[model samples]
Target chain A: MAGKPGRKFQLNEKQLGYAMVAPALVLILLVVIWPIMLSGWNSLFDYRLNDPTKSERIMTESLNLEEYADNRYLVEQGVNELSEAYPEGEETFNETWTVVQNHHEELVAEDAMASSYQEVNSMLNDYEPITDDNLRIQSIDGSWGSDFEAAMDEQIEAVTAVQQQADGDTAVEIGYLAAQLENLQGSVLSSNFVGLQNYADYLLDGRTWTALTNTTFFTIVSVGAELIIGLGVALLINRTFKGRGIVRASVLVPWAIPTAVAAMMWSYLFDGQSGVVAHYMAAVGLISDPGALLTTASGSMFSIIFADVWKTTPYMALLLLAGLQTIPNTQYEAAEVDGAGRVQKFFFVTLPLLKSAILVALLFRTLDAFRVFDLIYVLTGGGPANATESISVFAYKALFEQQNFGAGSALSVIVFVCVAIISFIFVKLLGSDLFPERAKK
Target chain B: MLKNQAGIRFYIFLAIFVFLVMFPFIWIFLTSLKPQNELTSFAWFTSNATLESYASAITTRPLFRYMLNSFVVSGLTTVLSLLIASFTAYAVTRLPIRGKTLILGLVLASSMFPPIAILSPIFNFVTDTGLRNSYIGLVIPYITISLPLAIWILATFFQKIPWELEESAKLDGATPFQTYRQIILPLATPGIFTTAILVFVAAWNEYLFALAINTADAWRTIPVGISFYQSEYTVPWGDISAATVIVTIPIVILVLIFQRRIVSGLTSGSVKE
Candidate 1:
């Protein structure tokens, strides 16, 4: 609207707003929303990098042409030697070899499979590896895939029967051919996609429930502790005091430490043998034994909650402190003049006034604590028996350590749903004004 | 007069509080300085102190390289997030954009989306695009996640900034870009500084993405680097403590120097809401 009155070539305010919002929205889409949507989509498949057949998210059955070609050559040589060794079983060997050869030719006769077959065969002949998954992997009909597999199985069975009936070198060579034929059959890939099956499997998985419970327990315990202690610290620091700045900064040292590094520090302090905290706690009768902290399930949970509380209390306090600062001195003064004690004034004035800050801080800390990863990871590595593994850690193990992307992404989606629910409860039920525009206006 | 009687008690409580908070740092420092043989010994004070752990913390690994990597990744994340979030915050706060509240809410909600939920897809994308183990790879997601905080903090600050100055500048024939560049940015320095510090700290401290994306030692940051100290069968407590101290020094310095800004930055949005 202002463009008409503005200098030439200068955009209007709305246009400028769009321009400003572009990069961040684009970034958020690409780096945040896009990735989440991708994970959600990926969770529908049975994808795992460790298993070659299920390494990719497949919508259609495909052939691994390089593998097919390599195994085909081996099958041919193996069957030929079997025929030479057992002249009596030559008919059986020829029949098995012809069936495999015919199937290979039939598979290549398909338009999509043909080009991939040629390319993969040429690459193999040149002793070059297939780098492109698409080029090396060709699509096939679902029925054809099942039929081919059944056909290969029959050939393998026939060859095995012949080997059983024969003697000496004949038996051994026929056995070798049968094994090679089976390996060739193994190269045929089907659609890896099993929509929503990963989610269903994990939903029924005990480990998933254990991780969810662990995450819930960690979030509840740690955030609850942080809130109470943080409120106390906030009140303490809010008062006029000597060296207040130093105290404030010192308290933040735990929060300011990189989470992984803080976990490292705590792991040291919780170290059974050399840890001073463990020693002191034992001496103080806080623990029955010094060495039992990190090794036991409940104890490891307590240790992580303790470490998380120590690291995050300052953050909670900082938020609460700002909230505390906003409350006018006159409110407290009025309460005091009315014969209200400290306890009365706090409950009637401070807590009611500080609700928004408490809600916001609790929401943030709960979400963060629920997603606890680096701290638990560096400290316990999800422990002696995975008693302390959070959902994030569980997802990490599934995705990276075990290369089960489908299950990992499913776990990831579960975390997202939990976080979304927590946020909804906070924003809608508790009436926390996360965006204060309407209230402010 | 009544407040004065509680003064001694308050100081005593404060001393206890400070001690509780500072003990871990003090112990780690002491442990870092202690020799290997003295580590398991049950002495409150070490009579012998050596810098041998610190020496190995640097010598036995490319600790300096990790520091540089952290610096590059965090520094870039800070600058980029600050630059972009400031514009977005300014637009959301000052412009006549419809659904400003919705935009703010979306940003806040995105920040709360669990990092693990997003990590798998990000890992796959980074792996596919061949951005793995590179600063850009790490910086991209760092910027995305940190943007919400930066935007929230900056919006709060920008809302407080008087718009009259911008109006006068526009009347004086300054283009929108010039007014923003010359006047708005300079005035928003404190807010920018606060956002920068928060973003930098978050980026520097991030572990999951750094751990997932970078397999190479060269691309690893301090947190990821310190985690590697666990690889050896014998847990080298001394070297780990030393590395912990080293990894924490920069953040400690930042907190010390900008304590007020950092506190205000952290507390502003939550308090304002």
Candidate 2:
């Protein structure tokens, strides 16, 4: 109904540009930046999936009402039975029972905990499980929670002392009562926050150092080999040759294969009993036996480096080849006229001209190799005495396999820091190559 | 005579290099074709090559289902990322956007983020949202991971387009969106196609997130599915090799067909003019 169609709806160019970019910015912030911040926060806690007390990310002292109600019920019943059966210890039993009741009453009377307590108690009475975490756990006063825990501990000690002095059924009843008190004490879940303790502990840990060393070694050796071989191949392929397209396509095969599948393929090729590569290596005296490739520490390291070089050399070659093609033939002709030999042409012209390309390629491959996971993971699973464990694999095992989220998050943050440092160094070395237009300005 | 000899040497070296590069594929192919009994043999050839391994891999596991899941996830990621990246690329290249260089630099920097660094929070998020085993959960993260390169490549392509054409379009009373949709999108098709192939391949081959988020048998992708092929007692080498060959053949063909496009896309900004 507007006079001009779409005029009212059309945004100005600047606004349109920002509008267009908003979706991607929001998505990247949500999925990438936000998760990283969350991981950093998670690393501060002593979080673990297997440990009930430290399962959730808690900032305050809380109580597991489900656990509390169940244990409290049993402790009340046991205390009542103990006082009825043993008249001489009736006073001790009464005192402990009153202490437990008083602590329970005080916890239930708190405004923050009253609703959760009633809900959990009703759930228990109705023979229903307290499955919802928010309803089953409530944050309480920290000092009061700890005080109650200390009181329960005291009662447990007193009951154990009575058990030690008693005989027959009285001793068993007192011991059972003491265990119920211990259970009740455990229901008070304390904050799992440990600040930088995980990082501090990992700094002193040997496995962390080993993983770092292995990752660096792999990055250096594998990337070094790939650079040398990739440069040679790039020079060779950059020539005007017959069937160049076919050759180039074939060269990309290894690069195209998924790293995980390539790892599987190499695992088969390195199989001790049936592997062709292993058999040939042993026959040629490259190794003492075919079986050692995946089993021995040195051989496992060699195998990964070899596979990485094979897998990535094509990519390196392609990157360098792009750089190579950009160098006009006139430069080489001028060099030839100046009496520069083939070796001189390569050293003087090629390497210098290829500097940016090599740096870019190296930056990409180094960061990639440093974060190497699927290839090493599928090939060796960082096995043979953890000889081949990369930091990524270590973090993965800690996070997923062991479910030690706090330690795993710490490892993840460390990976992020190392990657950031590597990128910083490369960017510094790269100078203005990364932003040439801006550099000119 | 000397030149001829040098040419012969070069050809020989080329031959050897190509052979070395292709040897793994050849070896894996041969392994895939070998009968179950000859799988472990070190022989270069097997007289009894058969399709039994392929048959077994297909029948014993949901190989096609895994392929379908991978295709869906990769396809969705490619489309969504290409859409988002193109819009961002257009804005950065054409519009009077502030901090254009900084935005581009940030995009490049983000691509360097190690995937494992953010795996924990994303894993917890996916599990909490009940999206762990679904395609959308996997695609969301995949798009984020692929966006940096996609935007970079598209920006490069968009920058190469002449500014005169856009000015003319504006003079013709074409709105900015019309010029973008009608002129820019059409010209940038090849770049978009190149980015699609790269993004699709990346999502298809992603193992860690797929392994972690979609552990359910019904939702497993190709790489994760092949990883679970071993039955604790004996390694199913034949079946695995066959499945790998099956999965790899299409990707190989795709790379071969778009070899030039891929190379250009990969090295677009590496060597600045």
Candidate 3:
């Protein structure tokens, strides 16, 4: 096959290279990049999944046909019933009833929306669910939406006046009609595109600022503690000693445990009432009271940072240990021969040689710490007044709990920018090239 | 050379270090074995021990099912990441690529992107596409997020293999695929093993995506499932600890066995320079 030129139909090496890498590249793009772009798009709108009116971003005015069709019929029937029950306000009721009917007809009579309304009405009549997005929500003209909203408001005011003139059941019926008209008015979905207003709001939002500050505080403290403690552990383990393997393996146990499980364990340990660790801390006078670790804001933050350090310091140690192994013993021996004591040797030989490793470890840990979520989420639930809420926790609350996608995505984007800045500082400012060896060439 | 006090001091420091590292695991184990009645007590140690919590942890909820879910998702993630990453790593390191450093840097940078930053969009995607609660939903992010680390590990290992072996295989008329399968793979087993362990641990421990993407109980992994104990009637400390122990065992075992390889894997990717 090799002897004959053009006999084999194999892809050339470069083509093969591209072919091999294409799946991974495409996967990263779709899974990582595409969702981020979607969030960016979402951040531009006032989309809230909980509210039917703003469930989706509406560039053109939209009508919630399901709510509209149901409410329109109710408004008309209720107005007629009220007018008959109270003949004294019949003139006012009748006039208001006609106006609502006219707006309703105008809304259903639109050239762009008439057919869709008919389909939706029939679907609602048949008691079938409108699962199709287009059928459930139909876009109407901008002028029609505003005109209908204005007409409904006038009708509501007229009905409210009529209700005041009536008594008991008649007044209640008129009020019901007015409520239905108000709801129908709400069914008109105007454009929710707030044009980066969510970002502006989040920037000024106190909770956002608090979350950012909490995240920064947590990252700095936790990463600093992890680096110092991890380096010490790494130095200790790097020495040739008996049972070092056992000690090393023991260190990894905490790192090996799932972070959420670790968080859960700490939550138990820091429990105010029955926590053993809390009991011991209180007994030892380190803490004034049992169960105070997770209740107070500062205490909860300290507990979380403590837990994070406990969980990740071993990982830092392992990374630093690798860097330590690379620093040859001859350098230390040379330092010793130069009349350098242990402290002097460590400061001169060990610290200088371990700079790159420390930077790498700090980079990884700092970024990981700044975006901390599962720990705070599981441990504190961002609780006792959201004292421990990291930006990620806040974003989760906005997106899921509040069902505010626009606000949530704005928060998510803020986190992305902060993380990008941290990464930029580490790589560009600190001169910690990710591929440090490659940069030399 | 009477440095006997220094030796004693070193052992004392090591003992304290070992205690700090092992105490949580021991405490959790002890808590898991304690009876339900003892849970409300602030005792340093329980007088009686029982496996009742482990029984409840397994029987009261879908602990095994959650474990199965974690296993499937993590296992699939490990395999797919290893496969995709191995190919990309091989191409980047062994092939005639012009900008290898640029590609490596990009891969490394991708890893540092905040996972939460992409959560909102991923949530929208999974819901809209009806991929919510499926294994593939979690696995998709897991694969991409873990790819950079896996690729870096594999590439560093691939770069160390002498080119002479591949050239000889080519001269013997073996295709690239055959060379990779027969020659390179056998030599790169250690790197592949370490990367697999790392990816599996990551996927198994992943909480945010699992919690966000999988709404159904059937699809929830161990970490997300154990969290349900938090929201239950009262905090089931005993059962939660048991579940934690269940989830932690496999990873602990892997770490115990492959400690050195994991250290190398973590460092070689970052601190090699």
Candidate 4:
């Protein structure tokens, strides 16, 4: 009986515990999971921002001579009727028939021009294809027989039916995509989804690859440099010194400055006439011109990476410093007693202890660098020919500037995959117990 | 003689390190004091200096507005986060919750979730709720951003507190809340201060959410202000340097005052986690 009470009590307790986690779980779903899910679904449709309802139509309006030629055939029949009306004026009738034929052809040419004008008008509606309404494809005029007209009628109806069907299908596909896309990058960007088409177009968009290339390059170089410099700084500051605390504070100042501010600060410094660095480099003849870096592609990338390295190096250093302190000075003392070199002590003890911290620092920084937009946006706006745009920037463009959220969402999905992969790798490399419990058993 | 050689090497190393480290600050300070006209003047060391830029940056904008937004956001975020995290951590560590370790690991893993990925949906949520460009929108995310660290810090600190105190307090018929308030909190002051300072700085320096959520001028922070001020091709460098100095000086002083607590916080923050 006593044990039976315990089971019931445990069930009630488990429910209450779940209630405690409910709020956080709800938040994570609302914020993180929802957007990720939405982006994935949006990738399946053609949602363009420029034309919410239709595609761009380029109609080639060459003149249609078939109608004019058909008028000639009708005139020949009419001429015979005229000749039959007056046999004495038959000679005059023949001369008049030739004139009549010429006049009919000219009139047919004008009507054909008017029809071309109508089709061009339809194409201009952002390629909203006109298939089922007042404009039936008129007959091929000069066909000279009922059989030819019937055949022409059949071809026209068939094309109209197919085009109308395609339009309805495309509209429906865009609609489905638009709904999914609206959730992710926001409907402010796009509201239509033409299936399979956006995917083809995305494959064609070079800006996606441009931003991808630049960002990937920036991430590697910046993270690589920061880790190296940060490790060096951590090692340098590891020893006993008089003013070490003050020095540590100074190192942290850059990290403490908000990244946006730090990014802008460097942007200002790289400007041609106004930047102090530009002026110095110009005076020393290191750079052939002043302020060229801010305006050039290589320079823009350099400025961003430099700013990122400056802002984040201290954070990296702090992580490595913590790792260094964990090495236990006794290892160094033991090495000294063993007549081992400094290099020997560093390799044997320091590197191994710092492995986890170094990885943690890299993981944090790399994820941050991949999602880098603010620094690039405020600094260069991906100017001077798409030099500084990252995956995040491309998404921003799709969502805000151009307003094509389907494509934006597809790019965001790519970013989400990258971050997930990196996080997975981090956990795999560091082992699941990276953040070990501090609870002393 | 060997000691002398080592001492000289140390001094030389210290000299070079000190110079490299101090160069940026010295550059900032010197540039901060320079006249606007000489900002582009090609001289490393300028004889003339003034407090004009700092004075102007303060006078040019509603400096107090930015400071107020930062303080309100940071202060409120710290308080709310600390209360939630402390309670949550305390319950996880002390209570007989089923699978507390699993729950704690889940919280730690939440930090790896990227903020930008969640930006749009949160923005939509806020805009829908009529909280966009408002102080609350900024504060809400700031708390979430700071939550994982807060829970981690408090959990680590709670682990260090002896369980005997709680047991005795319980034997004396003291309620859990009373025990926590009377015994645990007083001893946990160091941890509380460390967590507070860390959260405070983190919230204060947060840029993306603050910029994205608060588009209006009335509710902007220092980072947003600096970004706007950088809109020109030839930016106002002297004023920016002056602004940098203005923004950094307070946090620097805070770090200096709480030097001991900051060290312990750092030591614990990076403790194999």
Task: Please report the TM-score between candidate 3 and the true structure.
Answer: 0.87
**Residues A212-240, model 3: lDDT tens digits:** 99999999999999989888877776766
Clashing pairs in 3: A272-A291
Q: List the residue pairs that clash in candidate 1.
A: none
Better of 2 and 3 by lDDT: 2
Residue B155 deviation, candidate 4, in Å?
2.5
Regions more than 4 Å wrong, model 2: A1-6, A65-101, A115-137, A150-184, A436-441, B1-6
lDDT of model 4, residue B38: 84
Question: Which candidate, 1 or 2, would have the higher lDDT against the true structure?
Answer: 2
> Candidate 4 on A290-318: residue-level lDDT in tens?
77778888877887888788778767877
Which 10 successive residues of model 3 chain B have the least lDDT summed? Answer: B1-10
For residues A274-297, could you state the per-residue lDDT of candidate 2 as single tens digits? Answer: 788999999999999999999999
What's the lDDT for residue A257 in model 2?
71
Per-model CA lDDT versus the true structure: 0.85, 0.87, 0.83, 0.66
Comparing candidate 1 with candidate 4, which one achieves the higher DockQ? 1
Top candidate when judged by DockQ against the true structure: 1
lDDT of 4 by residue, B33-131 (tens): 878778876566778888898887777776668888888989998987787677666766665556676666667556665665555556556765789
Candidate 3: interface RMSD equals: 3.0
Q: Candidate 3 lDDT, tens digit per residue, B79-120?
A: 989999999888787666566666777787788878877888
TM-score, chain A, candidate 3: 0.81
Instruction: Encode model 1's per-residue lDDT on B1-273: one tens digit a residue.
Output: 013233787888888888888888988988888888999977767888899999998988899999999999999988888889999888887776776766777788788988888888888777877899899999988976789888888998888778899899878877666777898889999989988888888888999999999889988999999889877577888899898888777778888999999888888778763
TM-score per candidate, chains pooled: 0.90, 0.90, 0.87, 0.73
Task: Name the candidate that leads on TM-score.
Answer: 1
Error of 3 at B189 (Å): 2.4
TM-score comparison, 1 vs 4, better candidate:
1
Ten consecutive residues with minimal summed lDDT in candidate 3 chain A? A432-441
